[model samples]
Target: MSHIEIFDSRYARLKAVDWDFTDASQDSLASIHPYPARFIPDIPRELISGLGCDKGAVILDPFCGSGTTLLEAQRAGFESVGIDLNPIACLISSVKTKELPPEFLPVAHDVYEQAKNTFDGYVDIPTIPNLDHWFKPDVQKALSSLLTHIDEQSDVNLKNALKLALSSIIVRVSNQESDTRYAAIDNNYTANDVLESFLTACNKIHEAKKRNSVNLECSKIFNQDILSVLASDFDKPVGLVITSPPYPNAYEYWLYHKFRMWWLGFDPIQVRTFEIGARPHYQKKNGQTEEDFRKQMSSVFDLLSDVLLSGGHVCFVVGRSVIKGKIVDNAELIRNVAENHKMVLVANIEREIAATKKSFNLKYGKIKTENILIFRKD
Candidate 1:
């Protein structure tokens, strides 16, 4: 026995994997940003470690979200490239991966001092319309002062960290219920003091950086459509691929984060155009059936087949989604597409997951797993 069943084994491993979102406070993981992209990174690193990648090997995540794979790859000593359509995702990933020099803490202190000084000097806070509506004048003023101080800093690393600090406050300062679908300002929620939140995030980053004793220099981020990104010509570099593309009609990631996108200077209106499987877009089209999903995903595999290096492996992490009362077999469709592209099916791991999502329309909420499809270009 090979210790694994070839038939449906791929689906089984992924079905076994669960997303255990921590109950820790909001500031626990990478500030107030989205789920860590480390899910795939951790798996990829485990697969590639024995293959002689000693921090300089190149890896890629074509559908990198929040650059989790890229960040984790960099930490594990692999040069990584990430491509995504969402600008906020790009910004968040870029900012996090930016290596703050050893002296970043001193620089952060200097920035903080400057901010406090500015406030003491009675500098006026710039008005961000909706922000004022939620935060008290004093809280907004302090945050504005800190933001301005960060803008004035010359140290690029500290500047980026300051920006991260700002983003980390989104939930803490909002009035919305914790871990809910909506986050708006309210008087009863945790009175997240802007300055306190900033300081806390700043310290968290510092501690994380300090504890990360390993040095790495292998992360690159790009903002672009994955389909187009994969189609672009490369300079003769071959590397293993790892990624997780969206389902046909499940999550509208861009719309879900529209508020954060707008706050971070992203134009939400424009991003709606390229978001894959956006709920709003699907609704506008009347509906998204299983066949439509199969075709769209097939197109993605077709594109991937073109750029993958000879003998390279592509690991696709995806979840099953329900479409029009049909159990959409995303894994099978992807396998079919991969076979159509002449790639050999290496494995399908079902990750047993846990979660009864409340946002789902009662049918799709009982998600118990996902699939990790492994294919080789041989």
Candidate 2:
């Protein structure tokens, strides 16, 4: 049967399953860090198993936020690659997919003790912009000391794990209201609070390590823009792609994670400048528009066409966006772009966003439902 016929046969079955995943447990390794609008693990898990792709086929996620697709692919025994421009997102993804050594917990305990004992008089705080505004004096000192101890570790994997643990707790212990909100509030954080939160985060990582038993080495994550990647960059051909591109003016990931990136020695400004569909990108005079968004997605589809093997599949989980008081059908826009690149739209399934899963505030854009568009490369 032709690919279109095959897709038509499976369309109803795909739509029959509940895509909301309301009671699904998202408290796995994905919970190690806080990321806005992350794809529930079930989405990728079902796709990887249900897509009927070859067992040896490699999966690719171009807009890999926190590596949910890569982790799911790894769990399903498929080699996967994830690409993102956010440094903190890259770090979180790398830590999630990379297996921690058996000695990680013991070593981390020592590091935590050292950070706690040496935090009183430590003086190596990095020059963060508006440090005083976000972090209290005592909290800043404690975090600096913990970072110093984390940096002293010789093992790259262990060090990165520790760094991620610290990064996970940075927002909670700071003046920032929460991970989703950028506003500052009066938070009475202490040095001991910082130390305890770090330790708690480390313990969670240890527990997550014990729970997940997968070929983590099979997943590779890159901290770079998707536009910069080419088909030749992969050693093998890509057979499947699953990703969720950001919505226009929905949320500012860079703005919310700037403090964590700053603590981890990354420049958030660069991420903000290049981040597609960011609020700032649209607010500026003569800034980006719907046409620009289409052009960018066209380039992405072009890249996917070049990289995907013949008959490979791509699934895009996208939502509608409001621009200039008009709603834009992002799913249809992407479908049009893919058709131009010789991709056949197989199915379009709509799913409601769970009440608890709504990440953005209503003032920006209310995304009640999202479309899951599946296409096959011809």
Candidate 3:
């Protein structure tokens, strides 16, 4: 069959499958922390089940933003691996899959008490730009004190969990416009009640941990760029790979969480230089374009193809991008790359943009469609 006819057949097959997941809870353990542009867990869950991965097979999410795929794979009783360049993303993913020890709750309560009692104690806050504009004096003090107390916890897992919890509260208490927007539109929203917000966030994390008590020991999440980590050996061949890679010229993730990363003691600048598919990286001045996107993604696909087991599946949830009046079909781009790597297109389903999941505004033009492109190794 011709390539156009092949694509049409796959598109039709995807349309016939039910993509509705209104009944699935968006408030899973993965929801405890926030990350921009996270795909729904139902997509990965269904893909894994549909692929029919055998017991002990390894599932991989190369751009595992916020651990959505990892959490779903764990719940389904499979070992999973996630790789990302963002430290905060790694932290959130790690915390999501953590199985709370018996001592987690009591220890968390103790830490909370320490933080409240030592609320006045001072710690050197990271020197973030526009710090004063984003956080009020009192809010800064409370956050520093809380982070200081959280760092005091002896258990690394519990400490990181609290840190993740603290990261969640940053947006609620800052001058940032919203979760999706990179630029801050100050509406005079100051977190006057920082302590209360921190406490509430801690309680929510505790409850979320209790609710998602699955043994997530079957997963390994790495805080490194995808290209850097592809050389590491997996215990078993990857049976399935699923992820939502960043779209070209859209969503500057590091800038979006700049203050949050600083508040939690992370150097956002360190990862900024190597962030794949960032908007600035594709600017005309950068001497890059949509073709660069295809090249970079092709390299990653080559890496994935090398590690994948025979007949294993790769699924990418990507959206079309419009830059300088040129439209790039990301799904088709990925399909072409995968085909060159000896993979067969399985499906390309265009799905409606969920009301809550719509993050891009008119400034970025309308992202009227997203494609879930599935491919199997030949």
Candidate 4:
């Protein structure tokens, strides 16, 4: 049995307050990319408030899938560091937190206009797996033309922003499965669908820039694995570590976004080798199991202990999984590992999983709840 302290008061407060931000328009930066199992920004906002870190204190998200935590930290006037192994994750995080001038919108509009003017020009498409299966020939040409125009831009921020806009639309216009699911082809869209989606995404960038703050200290996003980077990455002490780690065999971000990666000129095959907790790791033939996941996460906890301050707060957003006909409580596992490193569990706050996210999983049963395990470093 795991010895853990349950903070009833904190759990009650969290439950009373609405975690859903349906009314609040998420920053356009977060919407720029599609990511699986991403928690709402309010989770980070509430955790940061509860932790009560100073403005200058640095916040860190070790598994920053799409920069939701980093963006929220910056908006709340705190410096943040986001580290992810996925290159696409790093790109999305960069565009989300990167400082852009007021003139960025108009310049982006000019770039779009130039792209439209030269849409007829030939484009060099990267060789990708099943390229013909996912994209219609004309759709590919349109996307390629947009990418070519995006490449012409000299400004890093603007170029990346345009690239993100393209990423936001790729899956929608593709023959691949829906945004939530991967691999299996389902629907197809015309070339106009691709163009319209790209333009709409560009408009989102404009809206996101409206809330941009020049005074917010820039956030640094790293494309390296957490184990390698958390060892000695930050010069400043990390005050709060808020993140939602990938579940065992539940999601593979690289596989889900392979088409987007191919369109963006990144090799998804390279990321697959190092991606932790992928579905294939659960196969009996692969000779990996839940124990592998526990070991990997234990390593992450040990590495994070090095950078986080002595009294720093760690809020892990995790859900329980059913493995081998038994329930695997990830929160309990993480608590046990943290206790070994002299960290005390302050709360095991359980919250209901979002209705939309509670999809059926044949192997893992169903995830109906998530635990916000709050810990204090001793």
> What lDDT does each candidate get?
0.61, 0.82, 0.74, 0.74
Give the TM-score comparing model 2 with the true structure, all chains together.
0.93
For model 4, how big is the CA root-mean-square deviation?
3.8
**lDDT per residue, candidate 3, 301-344, as tens digits?**
87888889887889888878876678888888988998999998
Q: How far is candidate 3 from the true structure (C-alpha RMSD, Å)?
A: 3.6
TM-score of 1: 0.79
Model 4 C-alpha lDDT per residue in residues 1-378, reported as the tens digit of each score: 112345545434444445443343455555557776556777888888767564456899998888888878887788899988888888888877887655666765675666566667766777878788778887888888778878888888888878888898888888866876656565667666777778888788778766665367445788887767655667777889998887776667788777888889887887777787666656556555667778888888887788778878888988776555567788888888888878878777666654553311223547776777888886
Candidate 3 clashing pairs, residues 3+ apart or interchain: none
Q: What would the per-residue lDDT of candidate 1 be over residues 1-378, giving only the tens digit for each residue?
A: 012223434334433333232221122334436442224334555445422232333677777776666666666666777777887677666666666667666766776677766665675655344665555556656666776767777766667666776666654565534423554545543223566667777787777656543466545566877656655544334356777777666766675555555555667777788777665655665765667666766776666677667777777777677665566777788888888888887766665532332112223434556666777776
lDDT of 1 at 35: 42
TM-score of every prediction relative to native: 0.79, 0.93, 0.88, 0.87
Name the runs in model 3 displaced over 4 angstroms. 1-16, 20-25, 28-30, 180-192, 357-363
The candidate that wins on lDDT is 2
Query: Model 3: which ten-residue window has the lowest total lDDT?
Result: 1-10
